[model samples]
Target: MAETATHSGTAVRVYDLHKSYREGAHALEVLHGVNLDIARGDLTLLMGPSGSGKTTLLTIMGLLMKPTSGRVELLGRDVTSLDESALPALRRRHVGFIFQNFNLLGALNAAENVEVVLGLQGVRGRAARKQAMALLDQVGLADRWSHLPDEMSGGEKQRVGVARALASQAELILADEPTGNLDSRTAAQVVDILRHLAHTENRAVLVVTHDLGLQEHADCVVRMRDGTIVEPHDGVAA
Candidate 1:
């Protein structure tokens, strides 16, 4: 995959990031002195095998986990030291996430599931519902807005998850194996949506995956191995 054209603005910056967990008497480092910059409006793919720190890097970028050491700057704000109370607001406003499992509520309809995230961000009932419906429509799930998770196929559920991620109008999106559960055709569709979100909507997208087929849609690929970035090709880690 070719690197996305670098924009003048920086979307994310990491300085010497390090993360470790205590495994008995010794510390197991998951990420070792990592540094990266994600340009605004770029779609970057992170690829690696298990235990390669790809997911660790993604989670840190998404502010879902704090690094043991190092600095993270998101949209020019240093978030490494932010407290938990402030994190929720910051993450909700500036970052979005799409998990492989789709993570939708079994009891809620498509639109309702999207609305739940907006509601957490303080968007009221009617407004949240409207925005959720709009996002669902944008993701080609308008007709399925009333369908529950169990009533939908794997592809449909993933689409609903994508809609929910967009509900907050976040500038940065982190997707972890987003298409891992779908058929080839559906996976392609999902990848198209992600590319559209980054290039068309100007959102910075980082996707962590082991699937090489997604490389075609990525602007850059970053590949990691043994807790460190081993290769950076055209901005995709490979």
Candidate 2:
């Protein structure tokens, strides 16, 4: 029930978004009426400085956080007023998140890590394990399916994290600094996989990164500084 933004073929649409954090007596405003549209088959990268609010916007789009005002539409549904209790289920059903640190469980093997996510989505037992292995294979990690986090290279662990993110077959994927910890070569490979999820699988992919290396892979690039989109961009050369 806020002001709207124009868009098409968008899996996620953000309109007039604003966010604030309470700091004692004052509310520190972060996002300043940002608007964006993420297409189902495109990889959108949001780049900005440390306090530019790009990550805040990404979290809001992923349903991991809510804004102070404005609207967020995911797959065409306005989720601005969803109850806190309902968020987990909604996120489980529609969203997948990839983090910079490759947050796999050190104690759990790669397949087991993915299985845990499937279990959250009501997939369990042998079925969950089978699906997890298949996803790992898709990420080209079939050989490392049973490796623990400590046993695998940084790239392999991230690939497992990617498999886990895809475990629930989510429609929207939000990655925060996903390549920050990897070397240049490995980072490109990971970006390629993210693009595959968007282009090949037709999922909506939004990545929040400061790395300019990602510019070439993005279908659209939204640059932010001081909490607003400040530049023009195009997607897919069309």
Compose the digit string of candidate 1's lDDT tens values, residues 1-238: 6446445466777888999988999988888888888776777888888989988888899888899999999998899998968887788788999989999999999989998988888997889888988899889988999999999999899999888888877888889998899987788788778777777677788888777887887887788888877776333231
Where is model 1 more than 4 Å wrong at Cα? 2-8, 233-238
Instruction: Name the TM-score of candidate 2.
Output: 0.92
RMSD of 1: 2.4
What C-alpha lDDT, on a 0 to 100 scale, does residue 221 get in candidate 2?
77
Count of clashes, each model: 9, 0
- TM-score of each model, in listed order: 0.91, 0.92
lDDT of each: 0.83, 0.83
lDDT of 1 at 233: 31
lDDT of 2 by residue, 1-238 (tens): 1111222367788889999989999999999888887878777787888999978888898888999999998888999998988888888888999989998999999999999999887889999989998999989998888889999988888899889889877888889988888897888788878877777777877888877887887777778889988764422211
